[model samples]
Target: MTDDEAGAAPDVPQEPVTEPVTGAGAGPAEPAGPAPLGLVRTPTGHPGVDAHLERLADADHLAADGHVEVYEDVHRGLREALTALDAQPVPAPYENRS
Candidate 1:
C-alpha cells in the first residue's frame, strides 16, 4: 500500500466556517435604543403636559402661589425619563412557554 498511499484523495469536503459577519448597520456602537418594555407609564416629555397645560389655560387650579408646585415638575420629568430609560440595552426574557 505504498503507491502514493493508495492514490489518496481524502480531505475534499468542508464549506462551513462562518463567523466573520457583523451587526447590520453597525453604526452608533450603541447610542441607546432598548428598554421601555412593559408598564413604562408616562414621562419622556408631556407626562404632566406642562402642568396640565398651565391649568387648562389659566382656569386656575390653585396656582397663584397657593403651593400647587406640580410635584416638582412631575418629579423632574419622571427622573429624566427614568434616567433615559435605564440607559438602554435590554433584551433577555424569553423562555419556553407551557
Candidate 2:
C-alpha cells in the first residue's frame, strides 16, 4: 500500500435513490397522502419556524427519511437557540407610568 493511498479518506456509501424525507408519524399505510401537522397557528414571524411549518405541510411529497432529517435539522437548530436563551440573563421589563 502506498503512503498517500493508505492515508486517504474512506469513500462514504450513498443511496442512489433520491427518496424524500417523510414524517415519523407516517407509516406504510399512509404513503399516498401523508397527514396534516395539526398546527393551530402558522406563518409565525420567525423565518426558521415558518420554513419548518412549510416543510411539514409539504412532507407528503418528501420521502419519509428526508422529511425526518429536515424536521430534525430545523427543530434541532431551534432547540439550540431556545436552550441558549437559558444561559443568558433576561433583560428587565420596561416600566411605563404616565
Candidate 3:
C-alpha cells in the first residue's frame, strides 16, 4: 500500500499448471518446440476476457526466454483468486430416517 503502488496491478506467479498425463508427452513442462497455438487472436465476445487473451498472445512471442514461467509468476494471484472464487460448496451428508 505504498504511495507509488496504490493502484499497481498484482504480480502474477511463476508456477506452471499440471498438464494432463495421457499416455506419452504429457506433463508439467511443455515439450520443447513451438507451441500449437497459431497466434489466433479473436474477440472472445466478452468484455474483460479479450484483454487477458491479448496479453497472452503478446506473451507467446516472448516465450523463448522462459516467458511462460514469467507468465506463471505474473498471474499467480489471478489464478489463485479464480480458483478460490470458482470453488463450489459441498453438500452435507444425508442422515438416515429413524
Candidate 4:
C-alpha cells in the first residue's frame, strides 16, 4: 500500500439503500382509495334498525363521495323505523276513550 493510503479505511462495496420518497413530487404516501376499517356491526335486535346499520358497511368500500348515498339511505331507513314505532297501536292500558 502507498504510505499516504496506508492509514485510510478500506473501501467496501455496499448495496444501495432505498427509502420512500416524500414531499411535493413524491405523490401520495398511500393510495387515495377507499379501504375498509374492518369494523363489526352488532345486531340491534330490531330488524329495520339492524338492516340500516348493516347498510352502513357499504360505505367502507366506497370512495368518500359515494358514502353520502349510503349515509342518506341509512338515515332514511332509520327514520322510517322510528316512524313505524310511532304508528303501532297502543296497548289496551294506554288507550283512552272520552
- Model 4, range 19-82, lDDT digits (tens) per residue? 6678766644765789898999999799879989999999999999999999999999899899
C-alpha lDDT of all candidate models, in order: 0.53, 0.67, 0.63, 0.87
- Taking the tens digit of each residue's C-alpha lDDT, what string does model 2 give over 4-98? 68897667797786445566643333445555556664587877666655665555566676687777777887787678768898889999999
Per-candidate TM-scores read 0.23, 0.38, 0.32, 0.63
lDDT score for residue 77 of model 2: 70
Off by over 4 Å in 2: 1-41, 92-98
Identify the leading candidate in terms of TM-score. Answer: 4
Better of 1 and 4 by TM-score: 4
Q: Provide the lDDT at 14 for model 3.
A: 72
User: For candidate 3, what is the lDDT?
Assistant: 0.63
Candidate 3: worst 10 consecutive residues by lDDT?
46-55
Candidate number of the best lDDT: 4
| Tens digit per residue, CA lDDT, model 1, 15-80 | 986555457844345444333223423433654544443433332334445434655555666677
Assess candidate 1 and give its lDDT: 0.53
Each model's number of backbone clashes?
0, 8, 9, 0
Local accuracy of candidate 3 as per-residue lDDT tens digits, 1-98: 69558976577787886667866655555556646467677885754555555566555556477667646754774566467657967788999999
- What residue pairs are clashing in model 1? none
Alpha-carbon deviation at 17 in model 3, angstroms:
43
Candidate 2 similarity to native, TM-score: 0.38
